[model samples]
Target: MDTITHTLFGLGIYKAINKENMSKREKQTLLFTAIGASQIPDIDVISQLWDTSGQYQMWHRGITHSLFLVPVWALLFFILNFFIFRLKSWRFFWIALLAVFIHDTSDVFNAWGTGYLEPFSNARLTFGTIPIIDFVIWFIFLLAFILSKKGSYKESSIYRISWIMIALHIIIQSIQGYALYKQYEPRYEQLALSASFLPWNYSVIGKDENTVDIIQDSLLTQKHLMYKLQSSDNSNLKKLFKQNPKAQTLYKWSPFVVVVDNEERLGIYDPRFYRKGQSFLFEFIEKTQK
Candidate 1:
């Protein structure tokens, strides 16, 4: 999910684990650890450069987000943060691992989901459980996590209670995801087979539920009904094209007063920026001043 929820999740888990166990120093460490642990998996963003063929979606999330990497990364932090991390205590290790795990767990809800069981399976799972960023959760958790750290509140119950709330909130989102998923059938838009658009497995466009509208930048839009072939005969195909206004729209873009083919499907295209394979990256070469 969004970094905010991820952070809250980390904080809640920290408080839950540290219940009655935090030293003044440990308490301070726990709060910072919680903040970092939650937001860190997003370290994957750096792989945006390595997104060639969108393999980063599969490969990057595959290794770094794995269960095996947890202790390895934790150890890296433990060693690096030697002064900050009280590694002599076993509890600190447990809380640190929990913080990272919670961050990964929160990812199951976002659009750009991750591979949790990586190295085992390549499933990029998601529930579309919540908007990546929810301002209310961000605001409330922001205040709660910060206040607890700033005031150095030592109360263990407050931390436990916060974790309970976090669990309940995630459970509610889980139910919403299921209910929304069941409301309608998903119609995967069939692009013209030759669409230069590199295909992701399936691009679902039609809504499965009326109540939920997927929100992104407002520039995002989609159409449900598209021009289609009505018959196999060229005579009928030509008639159909003449009847449909959208066909005229597509033809307008072509200067080749072209011969049209009836067997082929026509499609609209969009220019999208994507990451190149790890070694190569997208760099726009500017034209000389004209």
Candidate 2:
């Protein structure tokens, strides 16, 4: 997600809880806190070098990214704010919790490429069901809040309800992601490439016994498509044609997507369409999944 989106999300959170009772300083502080703390769950991405002996281990997102860390960071923030601003520790508690909780929760939308279970598990859980920047969410938040002050745009029931709905949608996204795989995963081995490891890991397109495919824009990324033919499963295939026949069209459109065909040089998922040999790009291939 873009920084602007993060800031907008933070602003949304600030509006929800503060409603009406907050100082200007408190408002600004909340905005900062939301953006900063929401990024906290990602701390696991960096835990490796800090591990010193490499023996350090635990469920990656187990605790720190859980419901438990909300108050812990709040207390730490409250205590810190007390010394820094001579403010009441009790008052700062909600501010801290709101900031941190929103941060972690907002991030859960990213396909577990970002950890939601940090300190509990290292698994990068993701739904891959929707694009990172959801247009529906973006439009709703953008239109509700004005760029400049329009009276007490500081708070509104509409804003509060709007956010509640967004949160619900995100939760549903996670479930939809899991369900997609549950419906198709059993058939993956038979339908997917023999080389198929965790084909579903990169992008979540559930497989049938006969086929597995992750759809993307091929005009943007030329070459190599990951496709699976079923060992026997054909149910999803029946549905696929019924829904859209152009499935897996991205890879089919571009032969250069064949990264394995030329093992010496890999065809990367090029965003902004970077040309090959300009810089090296890497992916955790499905083959590496354990």
The C-alpha RMSD in Å for every predicted model, in order, reads 12.7, 12.1
lDDT of 1 by residue, 1-290 (tens): 66556766766666655446456777766676666766666787787685544344345445567766677666555554556664355555566677777767666554445677776765655554545565545554555666677766653455665566656765765564444344333442211110112111112223222211221111123323222222112222344344443343333322111222223432221111111311111211112312
Model-by-model lDDT, in order? 0.47, 0.46
Candidate number of the best lDDT: 1
lDDT of candidate model 2 versus the reference: 0.46
TM-score of 2: 0.56
Instruction: Estimate the lDDT of model 1.
Output: 0.47
Candidate 1, residue 286: the lDDT equals 17
Q: Candidate 1 vs. truth: CA RMSD?
A: 12.7
TM-score of each: 0.55, 0.56
RMSD of 2: 12.1
Task: Flag clash pairs in model 1.
Answer: 52-276, 52-277
